[model samples]
Target: MIRPDIRTDWTMEEARAIHALPFADLMHRAQTLHRAHFDPNTIETASLLSIKTGGCPEDCGYCSQSAFHDTGVKATKLMETEEVLAAAQRAKASGAQRFCMGAAWRSPKDRDMDKLCDMVRGVSDLGLETCMTLGMLSPEQVARLKAAGLDFYNHNIDTSPD
Candidate 1:
């Protein structure tokens, strides 16, 4: 059995120990842990709403919306608050436990951030959890979103800043 006290953020030696374990052993341990904490038959589902489409400025080569790439995706303006609310309602009706809103940009503008805050507030009122992936948000922006009842934020670290 895997150690119940195992920390998710592993130390170097702990990571090495895990990596040295056989694949079957790892899977068995993971299965045992999962069954202990959650029902084996339970599978949670959620939906994503692309609240804002395209027009990103980053040079992330893997990103289709990067300004430097010719990925054939069209740029669109930020979505209105009502549009995002409607999508969130649809997600909730479809039995989603969470609804995630996403915008394509390197960073959100002040106006866009305000709109996002409003959207988050609206979604929260519907009793559904709301999350966002509006690219890189500053500390102040994150605090503002949290104040507006933002449940989660997705900020991807593209790579080691090497």
Candidate 2:
């Protein structure tokens, strides 16, 4: 049986032992735990939009938006606030509960914070959860976004060797 205890200090060996479980047994334990905590049949829907496209300064190997890559993607300026609001509305009409915006930049400039906050507010006003992936954010930017009703900020570490 899977332990019901919640822990934040799992050691590497403990994690490895859990990973080494037989596939069937692992799946059974996972299903059991999932059924105990969540509705297995319910699924959340989210939509992603690239608010600013291409011309990123970061040299991430897997990203086509990197300026170092010869990917045929052309850089475009950030979408206007109304355009983003329309897209969020469309996403909501299509049954999406969350709307995510992405921008191709090393980090958003201080000057752009106002516009980004407007976008967040607009999406939130539409009754959809707002999320963004605008590269590294300063503490001030984070505070502004939080004040604008930003629900999630995605900062994924892509370790692909491609």
Candidate 3:
């Protein structure tokens, strides 16, 4: 159960109005809203690791990892659980409160779930919060990640189907 207090039914007009607000007005509104739900003085620090980089099939223009683009990024295989754990440990030593693992995938393959789960569990064992951006997930996949102790799922909503 996450953000049960927040409204999810904002109309497109309302959303557009919010987005179109002047920078200062938007900033003030954002801070006001944030303060209502959170301690404004608290800040979070996170270390991001690309567990799997490049060769994404999605044609999202914003990502350099898209295979359709001629980005210099070289595609790599999924990282081992040990490698990810090592990075998490380093992140913890560097004062990172969270570890973010990402993969350049439209959706992770079924075979990759084990490694992903293991990575999450390992990061959590180090006492740091775990987050991942593995693109879309099936219900079963989501359950597995939850079981493995994922604290957050960070998906980029690059566009919305209106």
Task: Give the candidate number with the greatest TM-score.
Answer: 3
| Per-model lDDT | 0.87, 0.95, 0.94
Lowest lDDT 10-residue stretch of candidate 2:
153-162
| Candidate 2 residue-wise lDDT, 1-162, digit = tens | 666697878998999999999999999998999989899998889999999999999998888999899999999999999999999999999999999999999999999999999999999999999999999999999999999999999997666656
My TM-score estimates for the predictions, one after another, are 0.82, 0.84, 0.92
The TM-score obtained by model 1 is: 0.82
Ranking by lDDT: 2, 3, 1
What TM-score does model 3 achieve against the real structure?
0.92
Per residue, candidate 1 scores C-alpha lDDT tens digits across 99-145 of 89888898888767788899999999998888899888888899899
Tell me the tens digit of each residue's lDDT in model 3 across 37-79: 8999999999999999999999998789999999899999999
The runs of at least 3 residues in candidate 1 whose Cα sits more than 4 Å from the true structure, single-residue gaps closed, are: 1-9, 16-30
User: 37 in model 3: Cα distance from truth in Å?
Assistant: 2.5
Model 1, residue pairs in steric clash: none
Of 2 and 3, the candidate ahead on lDDT is 2
TM-score of model number 2: 0.84
Candidate 2 scores a C-alpha RMSD against the true structure in Å of 4.2
Q: Kindly give the number of clashing pairs for every candidate.
A: 0, 0, 0
Q: By the TM-score metric, which is better: model 2 or model 3? A: 3
